[model samples]
Target chain A: MTDGQETIKSSIWFEEAEADNPYAAASCYCSGYDVYGDLLGKVSWVQYLYLLFKLDLPDPQHARLLETLAVALANPGIRDHSVRAAMNAGVAGSTKASALMAAVAVGAGNLGGGREVYLCLDLWHHLGSDMEKWQHAISQPSQDERIDVWLPMEHFPGFDPNGVTCPRPVVQTLALLADIGSYQPLIWLRDHRSELEAATGYPLSMAGVAAAAFHALGFSSEQAEMLYLLLRLPGAAAHALEQEQHGWRQYPFFGTALKPMADADYQSLMKTTEAK
Target chain B: MMESTRNSLAYFDNHWPTNKGAWFPGEAVRYREMSLFDDFRDKSWMDLLIYGIRGTMPQPEVSRLMEQIWIICTSYPDPRLWNNRVAALAGTTRSTGALALGVATAVSEASIYGRRPDIIGCEFLISTCDQVAAGGELDVIVMEYLKKHRSIPGFGRPIISRDERIEPLLAVARELELDRGDHLALVKRIEDVLDRKRMRMKANISSYCAALLADLGFSPREFYNTVLLSFTGGIMPCYLDAVEKPEGVFFPLSCSKIQYQGAGIRRLENVKK
Candidate 1:
């Protein structure tokens, strides 16, 4: 109000050291329920996560959906780079939490975790209710237009380079669900399946569904990546525990690859061992 | 992106030919015409475990089991199943977490035969029929499993009255000349008793896998670990299915379809209006 500059005020947070000893309230909350006193323990972890991120709980079906997807994401094997990183750390004698952190850290990268999912979600947000825009953008474009306009890159974010094709089972499942539930984003994606496949040389990926799912589940773009880490946590921990039990030794990469030298060099190398 | 690619290419080019060893063309990695049994026989069981689970090379049986798991998983991806529903809701291509949960939950239950939670140890299979190991009665193990867990690990499935996998997997085992294991006989006995009880619960793929793992000389814990890893092969395709699509494009459903029973639309009346 003074000199055209307005004073700012906020009420989302407060520091309370009152005589009555009242606890401070948060705009968001926890402890077996959300800020609105919804019972948290009654819901699945996926439901709880949705509540935390969006400050609202999804329906039971959606919650179940989230839970299902979360379960699918959990893999304790070595195929995942994130799990391998955790295993490496565990073998090196790091604590369980520390090893899990290592896994989560690797998951933050493009290859191991949810970065691709987030990127896909971001693109969707940018398009917003404009299916034509996405269609035009993703379709084959002229070389000049590609260089000039903000057209899509040669590689659409989530599509794989190993040649793209949607798995038959996923497509069939999605088609079945599409009959029961109607959503514009999914309809658009489903309708354009063949076109997208032909253009990109890859089928629609699970990340596409994930991006749509995240958006539908009311998660922000950033939460997509975080969710990846969160879901992978237990699997990583399992790997870490397993690695701790498996045989381990400290050695540089390819320590055994180097060729042994002739008599003089070998003798010199063994002198320390001989002395010991 | 271009810069990163260029940098990577430059680094690779710089590091090219660090060694002066002669190049040798090896056998083609793909076993297009080779027999699964023959390929499996080339490697030891330890190598199979290391390669199939923790390492890259996949064993034939492991691949077959994983495929079976994947088929069963993909069959009912409706909202009724927690794993499938979650994947559909999340818009994930692979149902990654759901698959993990499925495998983990499945493997975790391998120790149960009747309600007693018996470990599927080697002795259980190789020992005398009279010996009641791990508190599991040989003749009454099925009943015990029913009494304890109200369900068996390798028997009974949701959404289906019968598990179709039992017959085919059993047939495969027979053809492979692996059907003679004592564990297989015990599974049959359990199935027969369940049949008599009118439960009609046939031994599932997990039960057969348990028999196979036991026959292969894996410990109970190792059996659990291998089972956990074996089924993972199927989930990858599902994940790939989802990841390949454009962002925000899979199984799209609206918020209205989600049933809300919690706190209704209410204004914060106490806040200064």
Candidate 2:
């Protein structure tokens, strides 16, 4: 065994103390700031989220950028896979937490998902503002051999592999975000949006925009991934709860085409299988 | 109302072209080009589930083996299990049936335990068999696999090094006369090689099931999807039991349970005021 390495998990942002009663917290400080005494009700939630994750306060412009991104991510709609997974559980009368878990499971993927944002930020880190690098990288994402890392980029992280054209909402979002702040990544993206789309033949999706926005916010790839998952939960939660209210009868259901084998067919198949 | 085909502009399109049937609410519905209501109305859910995965129903004996395997294995209702804890917690908190079981089953796709290890183990055995067929030494191949993957999935569980489920699973397989597959024998030999190497890795329940299922001609992906509901039986009871209890009373660890081992009590400055 190795010495000097601490075994247990510990908090980074918070230094919490118990009240006279063990069940209650007496003093809670976040990143040297007194959370209850000085910070409560003073900063907006967007600013607080930035502080909690980044361990530093955000300027107004950065906060606005983050807030816009948060609102953009708040709901992916019922058609989205993550929200649909939650809705599937919710309609069947699953718990709110269960719906969220389902959402997280489906959303934590590489294609138009939170994990895509993670890999997108990573790609951004490697291939900053170079078009040639972007072209080469998109075609062949750097082979990440780490077992723990997600499967190699499933259609260039941010772009929608299944999309026909750059979505109207995605274009408007890029324009809005570009107008709201001076994040270099977003500026570059806005300027070369058409060129990139033309090169890849894949439309820019919300996930791609989110990856850029989060990268502009100075969040790490891992942190951006987590934020993507968290931000998208609001939509999953709302749709799941709504679907629960609507019940399974109204919710979309795809029936599988079942092909039952006759006894003779089964016997022949078994004989063939046994021969193998 | 917005729609488009894959990488092409179109008003409306279906992504899944091979989707053969659908439910049309009031009118007649088709499944596998057959009427859903008219035919196969009284068939067991097992038929539907198995057919949905493989696109064809297996022999009755295979179905019976699967049914018994499902019964004997993974029926643990103990709430202490990590997956079952989710179910039990949901139950205690009065969550709906779908939510508790759904989340619990979702979590059962744990890398170290449950469905993932089962799929991973099956893949490993298949790959290992291929390597052996090409004349690679057993121990050398096993060593190489371990070096890349770190730990062998479906072997040596985290808690209790000795698995309690393996014996019962074997007993059922023996009764069904499905115990003598080549993959099963190979896996046991691999366990022996591991033991000889001074590694405490034993073939756990997932490893055993993986070998059996591999012999049954299930692909790794198919096996992965098939075991999604494996832990539902165990999780359901935990959820149901917890639901019967009072609100928010499951475990309820106090603030003192937390050991605040971080930089404590700092001043409030530089808050962007």
Best candidate, DockQ-wise? 2
What is candidate 1's CA lDDT for residue A112? 31
Clashes of 1: 48
lDDT of 2 at B47: 61
Q: Is the docking of candidate 2 incorrect, acceptable, medium or high quality?
A: incorrect
Give candidate 1's TM-score: 0.39
Candidate 2 residue-wise lDDT at A158: 82
Candidate that would win on TM-score: 2
Query: What tens-digit string does per-residue lDDT give for candidate 1 at A65-160?
Result: 577566656763564668888888778777565677678667654433577677677877887647566667667332421111112244675554
Kindly report the docking quality category of candidate 1. Answer: incorrect
Give the true-structure RMSD of model 1.
25.6
| Winning candidate number (lDDT) | 2
lDDT of 2: 0.76
Interface RMSD of each: 22.8, 8.6
TM-scores, all candidates, are 0.39, 0.80
Residue by residue across B1-273, what tens digits does model 2's lDDT show? 113336243322322333345444345454543456665676566666676777776666667667666776787888878899998887777777887787788788787788767777788887788788899899998888788877887778887788777788788888788899877898888998899998889988788887888888887777776667877778888888887788777766555455445555666555553
> Once model 1 is optimally superposed onto the true structure by TM-score, how far is the C-alpha of residue B52 displaced, in angstroms?
36
